[model samples]
Target: MSPSSCAVLCAAVLSPCAIAQTSSSPSVPAQVAGQLPTIEIRANQDEARADLEAEQALTPGGVSLVDGESLRQRSVVTVGDMLRYVPGLWTASGSTGDSSFISSRGSNLDATNYDGNGIKYLQDGLPVSAADGNNHNRQPNPLAASHAVVARGANALTYGASTLGGAIDFTTPTARDGAPNELLLQLGSHGQRQGSVTLGKVVGSFDGLVSAETRRFEGYRLHQKQERSSLYANGGWQLGDAVHTRFFATTIDNQQQLPGPLTRQQWLDDPRQAEAAAVAGNYRYNVDTWRLANKTVWDIDADSKLTFGLSYENQQFYHPIVYAPPFFSLLIDTEQRTLGSTVRYQRRMGSHDLLVGMNLARTTVDGGNFSYVPGGAQTLSTSVANRASSLELFVMDRWQFAPNWTAVYGAQGVSTRREVRDSNLKGDFNSINPRAGLIHQLSPSNQLFANVSRVYEAPTFYELQDQTPGAPPNTLLEAMRGTVFEVGTRGKQELGSRNRWNWDVAVYHTRLRDEILSRDNPTAPGTSLSINADRTVHAGIEALVGASFALGGSSAHRIEPMVNLTLNHFRFRGDSTYGNNVLPAAPKVAVKGEVLYRHADTGFFFGPTFDLVSSRYADFSNTYRVDSYALWGLRAGWTGKDWDVFAEARNLANKNHVSQFSVRDVASANAAILSPGEPRSLYVGARLKF
Candidate 1:
């Protein structure tokens, strides 16, 4: 390419919306001609970024693309910070930054702790969650990602997802996507401190990015402190003109001290006190992990493409919970390993767009259980080795059957197996999920869409390890199978120079058989005992609406208001014991949003954010209820080219309330099930990019 063409290409590549060239590109960029450093735009990165956006637009279901650039302005400590503006996905802080009790579309509707299920978590589009269908608080730190994609429920066919909550893929940046060098610092209440550094560079046909971050937080309540450190890196290579491959590496270590649940009386008296059992047992949770992955994309032809990926992970986990005399406490020493692979092919022919993919994964866990002896040594109780493997094949096609109408259809078939040695358990499962949808385009930017689909989810290790024989297959738990129907509309309307509006609303209903649920173990209050519910129903609305209005018709000054809300009605479907009882743990309603004032000329923004959650049942019997709560926060920030400064105050009212709680079959006033919310706290942060 000539110098003039190179200039144009460079401008296009550097633009915010530029797709950029693939791994194998032309000679050095135009900067080389200007006596500046050369930059190589990787092809594989371009494909990943472009495909995510394109794929999301094609799905006629609940989907969202998160803006990581905007998120950098605030204190990005947890996954909650990355998803607070997206509705339907619910999360609650679970003692630490990486641990967020999460659920979506009523998936794992009643799970009580930080370990998440139903949702298939990913980093750079490779599976991070185990194959046995448990994420278990192992989500990659969102701070390391440059952006994210969320496909809710059955809409995630492209990623070969069969779980009810669908998929969340975090995308990291290359030098072309982010600054070559960047730094972030944060300080907050409760002895909080955080720092991170990121470096990126492009050399010829190769590009690399690396980052390291660390954090420490002293709990407001006793025995709740947490410390975490993580490192992330990715490098891309151009094998040839038609093939591009990228490799990723990550390592993380987390240490957390548990402040066990409190009784109703304990909460009312002093919400900041750690549970007596927790203090006595020295309850703690710690984990160390490392992962490696590779993705290769090949351009088959002008209208066809293929992508292949492989990932491997290893982890060591230690957790000790409440004391019980004979056992004192359940001490867990576990080492886990997981390997995942995927292949996808895409093509466009006439009016039909096709996608076919395959996903395979396997996980192995060597676990040791010991009975704690207080001040003495522990005694070996039992040992087990768990292995799980899965294979999935999926295909999807969208055809424009009419001028303004399109039809979408897809099916995914999965075969899985789970085995436990020493425990002497073996189980095999198979499922076929199908999806059908239609879209009607009303205008260039307005559309109405609807979909009906099927979902299946198998039990994870958490539920399997603590089993007490209940039914056939001996002590086996049945998988959950459900049918979902949904409808929604999404679009944006520009109304003159002073106002612009955007909205996305979706309503869905699901009928499930044998939904996996958990309740507090009677003898060990709040200790989860998983069970299968015969019948259940989950219905909910996920909506988001936002508007930006220019003050006095001047673009330099504006006011923006946005709201993300989810209303859930999850309950038993005429069960013998709990007839029409609402599900426990997950709240019925959630509201989060912000209203901001911005001075574009000076790059200033100020906003007030809030969270309102409805009261939730603490027991399947509906006799125990947690109180509804509201939290308010304020944020102010200024942005300059390559720089950002921000400050925020959270839980302004300092309300002492139950932020989260474990569920039970029946509850009493003395039951220990409550986790207190954080008190009023302030945080300040700054970011510099070069």
Candidate 2:
């Protein structure tokens, strides 16, 4: 629909509600009539929550929020588990560790392995992704976050993010949100064990919180093992009523064994076994990271504020693998340092709201590779030094044209530069992307919105660097760009005798140029070549629906049902080699649902869950297809005043399925592209809060 028509339709539905609210109701109590304004004033005392709510209100597209308390009640081991109910996202688990192949709205369609550059990641409103847009699954720890916000497509403009998959911000727990003291322990199948401790306190005008978690797992697949430890802490000082400053620090040490992928025949024979080559090479990855940051906010007045923050990170990486030459192994070592800063100003003027922001990030790396022969001395292969920088400036204005109507206009200008000194490669990318949107409030609980935006993304260092011997780096790759049109509606309502219902529905279409397509080497499991496609198309529908109703006429007992569905239609648009065929490894439909019985007074809950995924082509030529699969799960938990316990069972049927795979233009029968799913597993956990 045209922008003008979309606005008119939204106005027509929302205008009546505005009129009704303006008219006084006789049902209101006389004593409370004069206190309504006062209540509204006190309602916004929680500045953090209020500010986040206002930002969400201005968004005109898809968005989702995951409560940390909800996750704490279940297994929050991986991002896939954390986002089990979020729509429009497809997460393929590489269960050996926290790594996953994640795709949203077809943004990373060809990303076969652990390539997460399409999505922007943030921690407490600060950038966590590298300057070149590269991200890993382990950075955003679910246990450390109090809540998470997801903005799909162009809806992330408020954070200066312009990308196809948009952004995800994990808000860490502070003194205000964290419990005074807590301890947790978990035990599960495959010899899994985990423990965590958290402490929070407030003294005078200073508050502080600290959390630490340690975990180990003997994975379901052979040769797959992992151990990790993480610490997150934050402290705040209140200088005055209108001024606050906070400091944050985090440290992580992770090591994981790579089980790798198997061939179709091998998977059918023994899905639990790891790839022979990977086992022989003893592939593994180890990383250590430390980060420090500070943020200060100044309330200019009740109607205006300024925020600024700076962060620094240091990391050391170690990776060992055998890609093409199976008999020899390569050890990759890298030391990386990053510096970043963000500044933002927000003000309210009558019916108008304005926000201006700027972000800067720079990263430098010293990297090298070495070859290790069996029972022989290691030989130095190649060395390189690299640097990358990104800068973004954005401005947005929200105008209340009517009592229930809001119009928004915003744009972001981005400039990025990448340099590989030893490789003699350099590139600069720049873009100015604009966006416009409209939000119409149909009622206090309902909203309708639409938006059109442009997005651009540059290739990351991992994608451009050459891993093979005597091969030049990928210097000719161009930036990918696209335009997106989206519309959505979301609401909550109480109807039919205390029954509650909530829903979110969205539809979007994106037209693209220079989409990235990767080609895999025949003999290598990890080596790939990057090529840009001329044109492509991505369109889809995402919806989530939930309902709760009392049982047996008892308000204390209720049944809740939830459903999430995603339908995608992605293809190469009139390409010479692929024509209009469907893209590889992207499922057309994915559906998940759950039904649970809850006793609110007793804090008891149990649920049955199911997931169904449709098959898709394995290659761009549409010559091979993967079979579809369905799975079932169950979970039960009891949450008391100061303690909680839970148990969960996954893959109840011990089904054999393909979790993920590497995509190629055309594949032979012995491509060895299958990553097998985990077997049936059970877990139990308990937490004590004081």
Candidate 3:
């Protein structure tokens, strides 16, 4: 209860819907009062959504986009449910599926391994994690994504190297100029199922699209099970009208099972006990990915334009993790390749507008791992390789000092090199980042924005192979650095004849210098080893409010409401196993709400959602607490005129929560191991267009 008192109690409960939409009243049309005064303007939404929201507000950093109709209206399955509401992201999913982990902001989790806290992974922009030292866990198949974008914390500087918790761009969908065909199916509740298909065509000068998906699950513990599949394609061509070209492709497959973690007296005696005892043996995981991209567009005259792109990628993964006894069975294999190129330029003068870019990337990673001892005896192998390269240059400008002001400036420069083979360790880095922004309109649909940026991050190969001993090894991890500060605001209004409203607010701060920690040692009782720990600080605030109404319909029913809130303030300031505590698994409040009902001309809809979390601490010596939860969900839909149907229910109640925790070394002390969450589920789906 502090974070400015929960942002002043959410701005006093939204100040009465912003003073009843600024005392609304505006709507008159009866033609001919003085006969000669006409002026009404409001047209903007083409040019591909205003050039993708002005390239997401003059992108220099801090991007967030997540669309695909909000990931099929929040049914996002994994990638930790599409980034768990973003902002300074953090995600953890345990009890198998390779015990997921993702971190940003206050970084740790073994410093984002690939080599150590210099995060990088892209799908429609190539690079798919893996470059030896083994951090292999690339499982893409969120229905083969059609939208995703995340760039925060370390300002990716135009994506040409790992950018530490900054860079995730996945897009895969194209061809629509009067669509072609589509299909989908789904079923749910622990034994879930799914299927999908899509196709589009043009030929002659290209213009194509193809898609596929498959999913299955039997999870909710007791020997878990999962499966996934995907395929994708894209194409384009024009060559005239200022020239153009494009291409893309994708593929993925996965299988999963692994249900480990229990302790604390078997979760207080029977939390479905099974932290290994040979839970039926073969717990599996497998993956494969491929991508290719090319783009070109050149006008070069009449306000200038020239753009080009090239890309390629390949990825692979197979998994396992264990602790001892006849249990030790490990095998990991990886291969990666990437080549990239980019050059972009645009210009305009008078009211100013310019952009310039240059980028290059090269990557290779071959890896190996094998172990089968502990009773199955004999088998050990290790072979690792990695090579990396990056370069970038950028400039941006936009000035229009009047008509309600606007200004934006940017600068970026980066260089990187990394090579490793066993222990030859080599790393080189360089940086220069700068950005400034401002936008103000204040009326006529309101607007105001502000920004400032400078970011950098580097280190990986499991933070430099700190240690390796048949998996579960870390020798005091290191390599992490950071700085980020932000400010934000957003607006929209018009509420009277039919109502409307919107709001967004933000505040942030992050500072770290060598922050990376993950230590856990016990050794003889129940065993332990979790490594890494150093320094930290993280701060936050985020808010959102939305509304829409028109319930008294002339048959165009509608009702909408939304709320989102988050307030975090992690701290560990210079570590000693978490000096100031709090930063272990963060979570100091998070809330979400929604109610949407619609029927605009028979395309029906219904909704209800609520989620909340608070109370956390799973180590870093905050003693061990993990309690605080609330969940509710439901949805229904139908939209005809090219088809759609849906139903969803998640965690309805049935609470037995605890999504992750660790620390076990029993025989006398140190015991805490939980990871239970997931019960009550339902999903039903359908979609099509042609």
Candidate 4:
């Protein structure tokens, strides 16, 4: 028989009637077996949503989880889109593309180096940002995640993140996620278009998944066009019942045109116009990166598990940020390489859970500044060579000392070194961070948590090289250190037979010393300074309330309302200069949420969304202020088991406002330093799975 005929024959042999006939007539069973060989299949499953939720419940500080499946109902072009509903997170996308200004608890709000610091970005529990605690504008594509986890401040101790903003982790999609072969297409305002493809399967002992995406946008503001392409793939192998291994590969190319910031007067006149300097210089922020990693898990008996990881990354980028006179536009081009490794062991004993881990990273950078002119003319002016490394060891224990209470404690020891070869400069830092927390069970579905922790962050190569005036780059100053106190409650409960409600609320206060800070030079057009502040304080409240009710007591229809609010109160203390001044950037109050109506049986939903932001300061001296703004939008979608479609409309009022901007010690009220938010836009997307 031909292969096709054999397949048909095999199906017929496995039919219910055939099975009964084969039992009555044994020769029929032998004939059916001739088509194929006997085999045993093994499939390893990834952690389920409930597993991740349980893990987060063990944390005694602020934490959140975002389901990627839920995000598929709307346009997700930026990190801001992925994290919009997460409390305490502040993300503002540029006029187009994934470029964004992100902060938490008033961290990394500096003007000079907005590429982001004070936060660690990770993918599948491994670092995606560089070794030196800098993001370098590298944000993992959200499309590849099964879900995302956000751990704010010292809550990220388990991940070896000691920065004020802590960590954001995106978990890769896996075969167990049951993601089918898919094709996706999107169309939006400003000549925007995107296409994506994903393939996933589980075959015998091997499980594999791969996804690729490409996007183009003409942007709302002049000279703000951007393009991106990315590819992500992973394969997992079930070596045995005791061992499992996975490998990952990722690459992304981002090409973004710079519209730059506008002066207060310029924004007032026309928020859509690009800065003259940017237009004339043809400035850009372009990056190309590729990475490979391997992770292995060993389940050695029921009570113990071990994890090992290694990774290699290569990146090249060209960015033009500073526009000088006829001499040159300050440009940076760099080739960076990094090697990282990690090992962790976990054990469960009676009432105690113990975890110990070690992580190491080494990085080398070779780059130089360019004397750039319009029309792509350039010259290599100054060269840079740098080496940096970090090593960390950590241990934690979760002890259930009583029936209703648990105590969590941990300590992390870190050693880091940074060297500038050309300048003959070097700096070394070491610190030990300790954290302790308690969790009290209010009920099976509700809990209260309290924690106090210490965090330390050393200056990166960028800050160490900015030797402007008062700050001494040679010494690199002291690392930023902070102590945080926090209390929070989270839970879900059934309001009645037809309604359910959920809530998450947290209050946190932090005292910081030797905080690294930076500002654009108000007097010098193309210069900036990086300094260490004497003292500062950050306090905030993060609250979220969500509820769902069956419309008219009918299970076929429902209404959902969600509200999230954030309050930031940051200020300086006992400083000779800028005494008691509010921190620059970030609003004092912000609110966001949506009200949606859904037909459960048909999988149709529509929602109205809103965002309200209070005014913010443009300078540390509080001389200039950015006005407050409110935005309204809508989302509608229809979902099916194998196909889905969505439409997203934003800035329906076409409000003229600033999304984010640079900062200074004191503003002249006319310095060109504001980034305009996008105007009115609409997006539509559809996906098909097979």
Winner by lDDT: 4
Candidate 2 per-residue lDDT over residues 1-690, each given as its tens digit? 232332343344334323222101011111221211101212111444544554565678888888777887887788777887888888777746767677878877663454467788888778888888877424578878877888887888878888788889888787754444788888999879999999988887889999999999888898789999999999989888777889999999989988877878999999989888778667777789898999988876655678899988888987776644535467777788888888887655545566667778998888787776534456677785879898877776666666667777777778888887766778887887889998887876688989999988887765654333344555456788999999998888997876899999999999999886676765544557667777999899999999999988788899999999999999999987789999887699999888999898999999988889999777878887878999899989999999999998888999999988878778777777788876798999999998
- Residue 506's C-alpha lDDT in candidate 2? 91
For candidate 3, the 10 contiguous residues with the lowest summed lDDT are 21-30
Per-residue lDDT over 1-690 for candidate 3, one digit per residue giving the tens place of the 0 to 100 score: 222332343344333323111000011111222111111112221333333444554443345666554555435566767766565565656565433566655444431122324356666555454332123456355556666667655455445432445667665666633333678787777777877788877776678888888788777776667787777777888777667677877777677766665655666555655557326444455667677778776765555566777777677765544445453555555676767777766555444555556666777778766665433443556676878776666655555556655566655665656676765777665565666766665653445666666655545454544432353332323445455666676557878777888775666676666654433444322223333335566767766677878877443888887876767787767665456767666577777676888778887878887778787776656666667888888887877877777887877886667766653212223353566777677788777777
Decreasing TM-score order of the candidates: 4, 1, 2, 3
Model 1 misplacement above 4 A: 1-51, 111-115, 176-180, 373-376, 465-473, 524-527
Candidate 4 lDDT by residue in tens digits, 506-601: 999999997878888655555467787889998999998999899885877999999989999988887667788998888999899999998989
User: Residue 469 in model 1: shift from native, Å?
Assistant: 8.3
RMSD of each: 8.9, 6.6, 24.8, 12.5
The lDDT, on a scale of 0 to 1, for candidate 4 is 0.80
lDDT of 1 by residue, 625-665 (tens): 99999999999999998899999998999988787777778
Q: List clash counts for every candidate, in order.
A: 5, 0, 12, 0
User: Using TM-score as the measure, which candidate wins?
Assistant: 4
lDDT measured at residue 79 in model 2 versus the true structure, 0 to 100: 75
Candidate 1 residue-wise lDDT at 131: 85
